[model samples]
Target: MSSGNPTVFRTLNERVALTLLLEHGGLTRAELEQHTGLSKASAAEVLRRLENSGLARKAGLKPGNAGPAAQMWQLDGSAALVAGVDLTTTSIEVSVADLTGRVLGVHTTDATGDVRRLLGETLDAAGFGLDELDQVVVGVPGVVEADGRRVRQAVQLSGWSGLDDLPENVRLENDVNLVAIRELQEHEDSSFVLFWVGGGVGAGVVLDGGLWRGVTGRGGEVGSVIVPDPVTNGRRYGQDGGPLGALLGAEPLAALAEAHGL
Candidate 1:
């Protein structure tokens, strides 16, 4: 039943187990076995790996019951820091978090045309240089390809074509996708869509606990969802600022209501 990547898979499972321990507090190995559905041996193996990686440690013995109390595992809370950057058309925010997802440092800056300089500078300001980064998740407001190289379009930023330079390890994901991922991480069973009605109208779909990255990675582009334009009586509006302006000003709603004789 091994997938040929037992080490890698078990390491990931150990991380999941550690997350469960953090959320529910310490649990016995039997409890972990039930929660993770791993065999007792696999669970023990992962626990050993977690302890070795310094991400988790064995806490003191749990009180009561039987001859010897089981040693509980707890999150180290400061292992392998991760940085998340939310880059928008006008603003940028950088946050540093430990392995436990605890925010350690945060900084914000106004975004210029180029974000590399801003990212480097803000990362330095946060005292978290690129070398210390275990992972950098960037939430961008645009359609990013699978390679994260070319951006189809960013609704908030006009004339923004694509990124000039992106690091190898940095993950560039759509803002709404990031939102969905964050939501799913917090509430795994919740099924919902994130509608971002800011500079433009767009949505990120979370169906059956995963993002639907379609053929072109443009599956959730709600702005491209063409419906009959009420003002023009079933005419299609191209992706532009006109519809957004009307939506913001309530003109579109009013026009639709008037057209409907309401």
Candidate 2:
């Protein structure tokens, strides 16, 4: 999908072209011109601009194709750095990836009552200093307010409120919401809901190709839906640690399993 159209030469044009190239891999100037339906000159100009910005580069010649082998332009996927952190009650996953969504390094550790220490160590292990990060996104298990300041109702996490003290520029999001975001962005599919039944059940909804966090950002709490609990005299929900984990904690699951069978 070459972006050959004039596209007004605004920031959006560059973004669109870059996205096209990244998604489709390499494309020759002529191919871009054809795919984007832009004049050859326009395509060349955009390609040049992207190359200058260190966002795109020539990736050798097109191979085994019919027409004359042309220089293929590809996204300079390693040019910039972005970090993503998935924090849950059970574990934390930290990764540094490029603009092309390629993970350069990753670290996963137990979420043992200290997310900050784990975050620092993971960043170090992933070979990314705080300075190198152009953007930081933290996805945690809780309801993230629109301002992204408050972590409301993170019952499992001990220091949920301390997230406000993180690097001021970092973006905070619900882990389930992040999953839905990744699903929608990576696949571009609409009308989907990601139900992550881990440590605790969580969900994120995507409608019409966009994330629907709702007015309060607590849109995904499928586990909270009431169900019968004879022992409690009220409705109950499965606990976190996923279904099995919810059904049986370190203490109860063992007893139930032993009593039932092997």
Candidate 3:
């Protein structure tokens, strides 16, 4: 089925070609056509557009099985850059990567003062200016909204809020959700629950081969689960002092251990 729009079709073809090059590292026009099912002319046009846009470039030549060598095309790694920021109560960690997902640099700094300024400084330490970054992904300890535009709750980093004043391409995600993503990538299991026991308690759940963020993006907010107060054993604990935090969080655990003379 065709969209009946030439511009749309051309854009789709370019995207398909780019995807092939990114996944395989390099590909000839024939290989792109074979993998993407695009016509020879369509594939050539897509490649031309990608080249003109500085997203793809000719790498080298690949000897064909029966013919002369073919030109190998690949993604332009230096065309764009991305940064990942891990925001914690004590420090801010930043990692810069090129378009091909190669880590260019990594830096860490104290998490004091304005977050935007700290981000700029961290990027500078990574040998790139803030303006040079194409995108920024910020992982914060909180319940991020579905649209990733707001941070609803972050008990540890109380001074920080959403990425309102940052660049439009900056994304805010829950730190626990990021952990779940990393776990899913590293392990073979399709489903599991990751418990985060630190200054605050939280959880990330992967179900059916995907991170299960509930309808309101609160699926794995284990820290907010209310239970009987440890002191009174009658009333439910408040949101800040829930059962999970009281049992597994650092301060509470330390206090418990001290009380037992450990």
Instruction: Give the top-scoring candidate (lDDT).
Output: 3
Locate the minimum summed-lDDT window of 10 residues in model 1.
240-249
For 46-114, candidate 3 gives per-residue lDDT tens digits of 889899999999999999889799999999998999999999988889999988889999999976657
In candidate 1, position 151 carries an lDDT of 68
Q: Deviation in angstroms for 40 in model 3?
A: 2.1
Q: After superposition, how far is residue 83 of candidate 3 from its true place, in Å?
A: 0.5
lDDT of 2 at 7: 53
Q: How close is candidate 3 to the true structure, as a TM-score?
A: 0.78
Q: Enumerate residue pairs that collide in model 2.
A: 2-36, 4-36, 4-38, 5-38, 198-242, 199-240, 199-241, 199-242, 200-240
lDDT of 1 by residue, 35-111 (tens): 98999998888888888989788878886576777778888877788889888777778999987678989988875
How close to the true structure is residue 134 of candidate 1, measured as C-alpha lDDT? 83
Of 1 and 3, the candidate ahead on TM-score is 1
